[model samples]
Structures are given as C-alpha cells and as structure tokens.
Target: MSAFVHPDEIRSRFSAALSAMYRAEVPQYGELLALVSEVNSRVLKADPTGAERLAAAGELARLSEERHGAIRVGTADELATIARAFAVMGMAPVSYYNLAPAGVPVHSTAFRPVEPAALARNPFRVFCSLLRLELIEDEALRAEAAAALARRDIFTPCARTLIETAETAGGLDEDQADRFVSELLETFRWHAQATVSAQTYERLVAAHRLIADVVSFKGPHINHLTPRTLDIDAAQAAMPERGITPKETIEGPPARACPILLRQTSFKALEEAIAFPSGDAVVAGVHTARFGEIEQRGCALTPTGRALYDTALATRDFAALPDDWTALRRNGLAWFRYRATPQGLAARAETADLEDLIALGHVVAEPITYEDFLPVSAAGIFQSNLGAEARGTAYAVDPAKADFEQALGRLVLDEMALYQAEQDASVAATLKALGLTTATA
Candidate 1:
C-alpha cells in the first residue's frame, strides 16, 4: 500500500500555492500582504506578551500562514463538486450564511478544518456562496444565467478524477496530492476572456453584478483572498498610506480593547479590463470584483453571548460592553480555551471549576480565536464592493437554508457546536494534564 500524504500537509501546500497565484493575479494583494506583515510585526513588538501568548497557545506558527478565500459558484453541481474537492484537503462545510437577508442574492457556507489541531496546523478556509437565481426579478435574465451556468464545468477533468480516487483509496499519495493541487488551482485561476457574449454579460450584469460574475465566468475565480491580521485598525489606517484604497467603513464591531467575534476591512475592488465574446470578435469591458481583505479574529461567542453581541452591534456601539477579557468572560460574552499555567502545574489542585482555577492562577484561559465569518459583515463587504446601486436593492424573500443545503448536497456543521466542543475538549485536556479533577461531586 502506498503511504498517503496527510490532508493537513496537502491543505498547507494548496494554501501556499493559492496565495502565490492570487498575489500574482492581484499585485495590490501582494502589497496588502506586505502592509499586514508590517502591522503584525509592530503589534508583536509593542505587546511582547501578545507574542508570547500566541506562541504558548500553538497559534504563533500559523499566524503568518493563515488565510481564507471567497468564491461564488453558479450552480448546485458546481457547489457539490467543490465540496468534494475541499474534502480531499480536510476542509468541511460549516455554517449556512444567508446573504439574501442582507440583499445579496446568495447563501453561503465556509469550508474549513473542524478539528482544533487541524486548525492550528493551518486554518485555511474558503467561503463558498451559491448564486440564488430565484432572487432575480427578471425571469428571462434568470433563465439566461441558468443556461449559461449549465454549459460550464468548473472542475478540471483531472480534478474530478483525483477527487474520486481519493474517496476510493481513502487518501492520496504525495505525488497525487501535488497533482491534485495543480488541477484544483486551474479552476480558481482568473480568466481574462468571458465565456458569455457581451450582450449576455450585460443582461446578467443588469440582473446583478454578482450574477454576471458567476454566470459569465469560465470558473469561479476567487474574488478575494483574506489574510488574518492582529490589528485590523492599524491595517485599515495604513492602507491609504500604502497607496491602497480602503472601504469607507470597516465591517463588524467598532474598535474594542478586547475584540469580539470577527472584524474585517478591505481595499476597494479593482476595475480590471476583460474581453467579452461578440459575434465574431471580442468586446472590451471592465469588471470589478476582486479585492484584498484583512481580518482580526477574537473569541467565538456562545449562543447567549452572540445574542448579546447582536443586540450590541445593532446599536452600532461597543462601548457599553466591558473591554477586559476577564470581564467579558465573567459576563458570558465570549468562549475561551483553558490551559494549565506554571503555577497550576506546580500546585496539586483538585478543582474543575473553570472560574476557580482561573481565580487561583492555576489555569490560564485564552480566547479561542473565532474561526468563522459573520454574515452581515460578509454582506457588507459584498455590497461595498458591488457598489451603492447594489446596496440599494433589497431581496425581500425569506432565507431558505433548507434550499441552500439541498443545493450544497449536504448540511453544514453547526459552527457554534464546533467551538463549544473545542472549548470543552480543551478544559478536559487541561484537567488531565494538570492531574486535577472537577469541583463537582
């Protein structure tokens, strides 16, 4: 039997290749990366404890490597094919995001590693959104978009074969994994030539810019690739100085001393020249879609905490909430992973009460970085990039997660449950490592 390459290794290699490809395709993205690196370095230097904390938590290694990309697919077949492709890289679809509620005609899910250890190794994710053709008001335009989507095969022939091989063989060897990454990369590469004619493209654009992006493209070219930043505010402030045009406002919570959930900001989408097929010649046109996004992630909140967060965010102010980590934990506004401290390891304590351990300086609790995206924030990014006209339109239809899942061909794993499980497991492991038991009888 051939030795199978670990999915984590395959994922890491694929992420590196994808980042390189994106940087080449979008030069501004390369600049954005440099700016983020500078900001992260400054943050680590200014707060040495932050560096130590990340290192101790096993996150330091992956900090510079972390990234998540977003793609929009036009059909259920494409969504299912992509899901199978992602599975070979150890990524599973988690959480359903209905962008229709925010006036974007798509529902989405993020494909990412679920295991804590897998995340620590390399937390690469892809936010996959399926274009909702039903939301299009023009039946003729919708039909045209559907017909256009039906004619294209997003996956390369080799990619499809490799996906099946991996499923049958249980895994791919190193050679096969390398080939798989290359095959998959082709599907995401940007095509300067549109598959649809200029007339068809204009019709799709009239329905929605995103609709055109999905139906007129050769494949789902990655619209944006996001790099994780330790200080999003600094990154935002630095964009203009670096010759990058940032969005008017950052998405998600206002600047908090202890950031909650995920905060994202991005440079304005670029207008790129493209060629649309005409009767016998190519028609020149400009397309605006790809952009560079930066994000700072904080703790994943519990359902109760998320409710409070939603309420607070709705008010458009974060000042009412406590800014300290301890206070936030006490108020049940965040989730954290616990670990035994030096003091805890030295002392023989038989207490599983998390608060008691923290109070006694036996266990140190760190916020489990939110490994997810917020739907509103995502829609905000989409609307901002799509322009004001797109923002003005509303999709009044109720969100249909069931329909989205059916299209995806599988139900998304609950993101909250994944976070809760990681937190619980960390607590259990910490107790075992410290040779301690819970306070409960």
Candidate 2:
C-alpha cells in the first residue's frame, strides 16, 4: 500500500476547510446552515421512522458533511487544471451539463466522489462551469474576453507543482496534501480586484452578467456554496426571517412526499465592491456573483423515471409521479440499494423476490441519493443570481459535451449508469447474503 494520506480523508479535510472559509466570507451561510440543521432535527424528531431509516442507510452521519460549491472559469486551461486538482481529493467529473439553452453561457460538470464508501465519508462536490466564449455574439468582445482569460492562470504555481507530484508519484504525503489544499484554495478564494478595465467590465456585463462575472475576475471565486437540508421548503420559509432575501421561487420538482432528484432554493447574490485598472488610476465597481444555496436531494431515478420526470416538469404536473415509495419501487422508476437485515443473515431464503424478502423483514431497500445537479435547476439559480439581465441569446438546446470533455481531459461519468450499477451490485450482494440464487430485479 502507498504511504500517503487517503484521498477521502484529504477530501473531508478540504471540505471542512472550504466550508469554514465560506462561512467566514459569507456570514449568512452560517445562518443557513443553522437553519438547515434546525429543520432537519425537527423533521427527524417528527418522523422517527425516517430518522431510523436514514441512520440505517448511513445517510444521517453525512448530512452535515454534505456540501457542493459552484465556480465559473473563463477558459479551458482552468477547467483542466481544476479537474486535476480535484483528483487529489478523490473527486471525479460526473455528468456534463449545458446551460446554453437556458440562456446561461456555460457548460459544466460536477466533480465528486463516486464510490459508496468514499461518498459516505464526505460527499463534497464542486459544480465547475467553463465560460463558453464562442457563444458571445459580438466577435470583438468575444476575442477580448478570450484574451483576458488566456492572460490569467487560475491555479497557483505551487498548486500545479503538487498536482504533478501526486500524478507522477502515486499520491501526496501528508505534508504535501496539506500544502496542496492550501495552495488550491487560492483558486477558489474571492478576489476583489478585476482583471479588466471598468469599461470592459461594464460592457461584458451588458452583454451577459454571467460572462462578466467569469471574465472580469482574477480567478473563479466559488460563486456559491450550498448546504444540504432534509427539508428545503421549511428552510426557504425560514430564510427571510434570518434577514436573508430568497429568490421568488424554488427550482426543480414541486413538493412531493417522496422527493425525486433535486430541489433547490437560494438567497440573492451580494453586490461586492471591486477595483478595476483604468490607466494610472483604479476605478471602483460592483459585481454580483456569489450567493448562498440550500438543496434537498431525493432518490436517484431510472431512465424511465427521468423520462416521466421530464414530462411532468414540462407539463407542470407532478401527479405523474407516485409520492409513495413502494409504488415507485414497484414501477421500477427509482434506484435503491438493498441490504440483508439481521434476521435475513440468520435465515435461509428459497426465492430472490425482492418484495417478498422485504415483506418478510429479511431485506431492506434504501433509496440511493442523487449526487448530481439538474441543469435546469442550476441555470435557474444562476439566472436568479444574475438578475433580469442573466439570460443571453437562445443557444443550442443540445449539450456540447464533447467540448466540455475535451477541456476536462476526460469523459464525464454517466450519472444514470452509475446509479444503475450501484443498485445492481446492492441487489446481488443482498441476495447472496440471503442464500438466494434467483434474480430479483
């Protein structure tokens, strides 16, 4: 075995550090966290079965450990470097998302741990987006934007060095990992100085607020850091009381007894003062980018479930989905991880019918949590933070995954396929433990 800090441990440390930094930078974030924790406690208290189920499924311990931060880079080089940096933390790019059709000029991917054990340790994710300069309508502005992006290197020199060391020599020793995280944090740290002139910054903002946010900044400061909540609706209702101005509406699926996919809501982005270079004098300007978000995730859905989900979203009819979990399982619309219970371990089973085993209290199936983001919900959050001017010209409805993968230096893992594999493996393992040979799914 290699003598080095485990990636999961490194990831957990970094996640804690990052959250602390954000909490310090944005005080409201701490309030939101408190609100979420309070809401979760209430929900668990009200629903003892849910609390027990979550504890059994290993979700309760990691609730406070969950965090997803978002950042927007101005170029391809930044994307590749960030991917390598995330690799040190055991995060892999999962799924490509194109927000162009939603009028946001960026394509993105979520960098997160994939394995169940690794995720259970700390499911930290960074939703990284690369600015699509090609989508810029004005050729001259696009060229200028590209030039500004090319001039800046988001990764610190030491950070780059550590990434190389980890890649070439297997892994980073404890000291190297510590230094690596400290150096890499610079890339995501907030910068108050603009790379471009005041005039350029205003012009970019006029063209698209998101574009300006990406091109004007020295580095891609994490725009927002989200804390997971067990009850988002309660948290949303509670934000205003904390002096937090939430967006008008929540994004993603409407309320459901058994929530599916992701539901998100956020407070508005703050306008921070920034200095821009203008010849011999510095010009002062304000930028709106970073915000706070709270998300509640549900079970990962199958392809058929996703299709039904898409239709329901389009039609504004959530009734298409059954709110009951058993119906959801029976319909084969959701993915669940199966485990043999204590009684099952002590008894032999003749058949592998999953429902029968579950009915007999021999097997337990827990919903697999959705670890990724929804493009539409993501775009909604971006636009809400960007204000009325967020939407750009309607770009292609299709995703440019090829361009994203090329910049990432690797193909993104399919979220659905990962869920499918996890579910299948769990079922197999559960059946084997019960001494059943027949396939249940």
Candidate 3:
C-alpha cells in the first residue's frame, strides 16, 4: 500500500505544479504576477485593516499571489477527460455551476481541492472548460472538434503511468516525484510546441480564440484566471495610480468590513502580439480577460442565512437597506450560528429571543467566514476579461431544468460513487465527533 499524503503537503505540491503549467502556457503570466505583487504591496502599506479581511500581507504575499487557468470543452466526454487529468494532480470537481445562459458568453466549471483546509493551504486552481455557444452554422466545427477530443486522449500511456504512480503513491518519493513533475510539465510544453501543424489542433485553437475574439472577448487571448478580491472600490481607486485604468465597475450592496461574496471590476486587458500563418501581426485590442474583484464574506449561514440571502437577492435590498454588514455581525440577524463545542449544549444555551439573548450575555452573532468563489462575480470577471464584447442575453434558464448534472457527469471520468462515499465518510466523522445523531431521532 502507498503511504498517505498529508492534505497540506498535497496542496503545496499541487500548487507548485499547477503554477508551472500556467507559466509554460502563458509567458505573459509572469507580468501578471509582478502586477499582483505590486498591488499587494500597495494595499498593505495603505490600509492594513483591509488586507486582514482575507489574509495578512505576508500570507497574501504567498497565498493571494496565485493564478487560476481557464479552458473550455465542448462536451461531457471532453470535460471528463480533463477532470481525470486534473485529478491526477489531486483536484476534484466541487460544484455544478453553469454560466451558459448568462449574457456574457461561455459556460464552465472550476477544478480544485475543495476542502477548506486545502483551500487555505493553497488555493491555486483552474476555471477549466468554458463551453461556447454553437450557432447553427458552427455546428459542423463543434461536432468535429467534439468527436476529435473524445477520440483523442491527451493523457498518453507514459503520461498516465507517471500520473497514476504519483496519485496512487499519494505522492512519489522526492526524486520520483520530481521526475514525474518534470514529465508532467514536459507534456503541456510539448502540446504548445506540437500544436504547430495538427489541423485539428489549429481548428480547436482558432475556435477557442474565436470566442475570445468575437463573442466574449473583444480581441484575443482572454484571461485564464479571475479572482475574488476583498475591496473592489479600493482596488479600483488604487489601479490607476499603478498605471492601470479601470475597465468598468458595477454596484453592489453598500459595503462594510464584512467581505461581500463577490464584486469585481478590472483594468482593461493590455495589448499583445501573435503569430499567424499569413504573417506576424500585432492585434490592436482590448482584453476583458483580467479583472479585480472584491468580496465581503458573511458567515457560512445556516439554511436560514441562505434564505435571507435569497430574499436579499430577490428584493435587491442589499443596496437599499440601512443595515451595514457590520451591523448584521453585531446582531444575530444575518450570519451563520453554530456551536463550536462538541456538545449540543452550546446551541441549546442561547436565549430564544434576540433581545433576550442580548440581555442574557449570549454571543448571538459571529462574523461568517467567506473563502469560496461566487458565480455571478465569476461571470462578471469573465465579462471584464473579454477580447470581444458580450452578446445580449435573450433568456435565462430555470436552473432546475438545466441538464448540467448529467452533462457534467459525462464530462468527468471519476466514479461519483466513490467520491460521494469519501464525502459521506468525512461528514460522518465530523458529526460523530460533534455528538450529532445520523439517524432520525
């Protein structure tokens, strides 16, 4: 049996490998890192409190200095293949989210280590596979590409060997691990090099770039990663001073210290040069591919909090309400409430009424932690990083009816049953430790 890998160690190893993959694919990514460092420095020097909302300046220097990669696949089969490949790196599909019907173009998923500890250790991730709309005329291209992607397995025999060896061993011995990592990096580098002549490859690349050029992007090379920031207003104000012009901005609920889930705006994408078959040409362009996002994380609200969130979203009352997020934290009204102790006594000890709780010395409200990404914010970031403008939306799908579950099931090759079992076990362990009953009382 292979030795188990510590989750934190896995996080560290995976983050390094993924970052290398990104740099290899996007050389300009190095510039993005420098920009992030600059921004982090400025934010820390100016507003020390703001920096603490998510992480400390030094920690942000490490964790916040991350880049996420994005890709788009046409079908579930393609999605599955990519998922398996990422899994070899210790990633998993956490959420089933769809942005297809949203006004901005494209639909996709994010792959990463979902455990909160794993995220905290290193949240390096990819917003993998943004599927584009297939217009009637584009069906031929989509079909051919889909067929080709399904038939062609990107993970080679040797590549799979190294990956499986690494994964099953929970991580290779230092030398073997390093060798596998090298091989893995070489695989992606090889693709970027080998793609020169493959017609299928060219078609896919063109189609991928087309979405960036015409649909969602205004030009070419849309951003691969979009992050959620803690302060959109501050980030916006600070950008121009650093020579970055705000691409655009949007309104969210009146902000307070509490991190809102997602509010994003970014500086316009800078121009770049590309090589084409005809000749080398510089594309005078604007890219909506990169953006700055800020969020106020609320407590991991219980079902009640989610209901309140839904009510807030529906009424669009977050903006109109006089209650600041801090006020919510002060009161028991809008955050998650739970007992930290193993016994249920902590929950039971709280006074029943809010006023009574206040009088009875109960700590009714606690600030919710926000570490997860937001979808609307994600779509907004996607909109900002575009090479082309977004087409107007005609309709919104009832999420209940959307076939993303099955579609996604087809896209990933992992056994959901096994994944689910692992999740159940994790949950049961937590409940048992907390002295909660799993069976109906």
Q: In the order shown, what is each candidate's alpha-carbon RMSD?
A: 1.4, 1.3, 7.2
Model 2: per-residue lDDT, tens digit, 184-204? 888889999999999998889
Assess each prediction's global lDDT (C-alpha) against the native: 0.90, 0.90, 0.47
lDDT of 3 by residue, 201-229 (tens): 34543454434332221111224544434
State which candidate, 2 or 3, has the greater lDDT. Answer: 2
Question: Residue 300: error of model 2 in Å?
Answer: 0.6
lDDT of 1 by residue, 100-219 (tens): 978799999999999989999999999999999998888888888888889899889999999999999999998999999999999999998998988888888888888889989889
Model 2 C-alpha lDDT versus the unseen true structure: 0.90
lDDT score, residue 41, model 3? 64
| Clashes in predicted model 3 | 26
- State the RMSD for candidate 1: 1.4
